[model samples]
Target: MKTRAITGFFFIVVMVGAMLLGAEVFLGFFTLLSAWCLFEFYGIVCSEDRKPNKFLGILTTSTLFITTACYSLGWLEAKFILLFIPVLLAIYIHALYQKRDFPFNDIGFTILGILYVGFPFYCFTRLGYITGDFNHFLPLGFMILLWTSDTGAYLAGRSLGKHKLFERISPKKTWEGFLGGIILAVLVSLCLAYYFQTIPQWQWIVTAVIIGVFGTLGDLVESMLKRSLNVKDSGNILPGHGGFLDRFDGLLIAGPLVYLFLYLAN
Candidate 1:
């Protein structure tokens, strides 16, 4: 418990600084984080007691990060879309050259993992650009809401929770705790709205609901990945936190959800 809280504070400080700095500082942080997530995924989804293609993994993973950074930095919009066209081409060529040594599922998983984690995350940076320097608070504020929700759920579950929300996928989760999380998130959001002093009441309420619900779902999604891989943690990159993915899973869903809501609602 002590370790989790201590490490959690350190992680929050680093992330908050990055988002507050904005521009290249923020982009560089995400670039490293996104790349690390790609590596972690490849490590988890290994094949039949055999090693995966390290070179290919690096290439595709870097592609995802670079394209995302470029898109975020306003260099190109469709640059990352090219990842799809080459996948088909390489799949055909590798099948012919390797004469069946080529692994279809492994290759496909690499592509899918990048798209799943990388694409949604890019939306946050895009949001940063949309709002200019002022919009920098978007992801930062959303993340705090996610943190608040998780904290509320953890405490509530330990104290008052009774019925489990999903006994199989997430045994620790409960409906009572989930509601507690939502209520806590909404209440904290009101406080943050006062601090930030720009986001309207209705939007802040919507943001709170999105973070509470999607953040929990994101936590479950990570658990599902671990359950399928038969592993407990993605990587030991963060002490008591698990991995980059572990820490940012909630933000992944919440970031894009907030981006879309603010984009369309306004």
Candidate 2:
């Protein structure tokens, strides 16, 4: 318990500090995180004797993330993104030479990793620059709301849980916990509105609700993956946190939705 708490504390400090530092630090940190998460995802999926071209998977995912970062930073043009087409096509072409069974399955999982882990993180990178200028408030606020929701849910579920939220996938989650998370996230949103004056209070509240709902769904989705794989945790990377995928599962789904919300609200 102490180890988990200590690891989580340092994780939060580093995450918050990267965001507070500026865009360069934020992009570099998350890009590395994106790569690590992609690596972890491929590792888990391939653990069942299913070979996903880890080399190409990581390469393409890293390319996608780096391209997104470069584009976001105005270091590259939109045309540069077209370079991914041939590289992706190379996946199919390379599969023809392998004598392995279910090569298509390998291809499918590889592409899915890019969609599941890579794209969402690319969206997360965009969130840091959503205002056409780099400001720490939006990304930092989002993380705070997400962390608050998770914490609230865990506390409430332990103490007041009665009904199962999703017994089949995540038996521990409860409706009581879900609502508890929403209430706390909404409260945090109100505070974010007060401090981060860029967006209105109502939008922050809406975003909090989005994070609460979609964030839980994200957790469930990752849980579903692990359940399918019959594993206890994704990996043993972060002491008690399991892996990058486990820690940022909420962010994966919530990041894209929050980006959309910000776009529409603006």
Candidate 3:
């Protein structure tokens, strides 16, 4: 528990500091982070006969993230993102030369890593630049709500949990915990709205609700992935936190949802 708490504290500090630094640092940090997460994803699914083209996968994902981030920052045209298509095609072409029996399966996992890990981080990066400027508060506020929701759920589940939320996928989660997450996230949204009025108060509340709901779904999705892969954690990169994927899985689903909401509403 102490190790977990320590790791969480440092992780939060580094994340908050990077985001608050500026747009370039924010993009650079998450760009590497997304790549690292992709690497971890590949590691989890690889086997004797199924080996994803990790180099190509990481390269392609990093390219995608960098292009999207550059476009968001107004440093590159939207067409640069089209480059990602060709890189993905290259992954397919590269797989054609490999002597694996299940080449297509490997290719599928590679692309899945890109979509599952890279795309969402791209969306999270976009959150910082959603307002046509580098406003750190939006992304930071979203993360704050996410953390609060997770904390609330854990605490509530431990103290008052009874019925399981999804026993099949995650036995530890409880409906009571889920509601606690939502309630706490909504409360935090009020604070976010007060300080960062980039979006309306109602929007923040809605974003909180989105984080609570979709974030839990995201956690379940990752849990499902691990269950299928027959693994405990994604990797041991984050000490007690498992890996980059475990720490950021909630952002994967919630980020895209929040991005779409703010983009469409804006």
| Highest TM-score against the true fold, candidate | 3
lDDT of 3 at 210: 98
The TM-score between candidate 2 and the true structure equals: 0.96
Superposed Cα deviation of residue 57, candidate 1 (Å): 5.5
Give TM-scores for every candidate, taking all chains together and pairing residue i with residue i. 0.85, 0.96, 0.97
Identify the runs in model 3 with alpha carbons over 4 angstroms from their true place.
Answer: none
TM-score of 1: 0.85
Write the residue-wise lDDT of candidate 3 on 9-94 in tens digits: 99999999999999889999999999899999999999987788899889888888888878877889999988878888898899
lDDT of 2: 0.88
C-alpha RMSD of candidate 1? 3.0
> Tens-digit lDDT track for model 2 on 207-262?
99999999999999999999998877778989988988899999889999999999
Q: Which window of ten consecutive residues has the lowest lDDT sum in model 1?
A: 91-100
| Candidate achieving higher TM-score, 1 or 2 | 2
lDDT of 1 by residue, 1-266 (tens): 89988988888899989898866777777767776776787788776743444455556555655765666667879656477456435633554454345466655765666666666666766666555443666667777888899989988988999999988989989998898899999999998888875567778789999989988888888888889889898899888888888887786677788889988876
Number of clashes in model 3?
0
Ranking by TM-score: 3, 2, 1
List the lowest-lDDT window of 10 residues for candidate 3: 65-74
TM-score of 3: 0.97
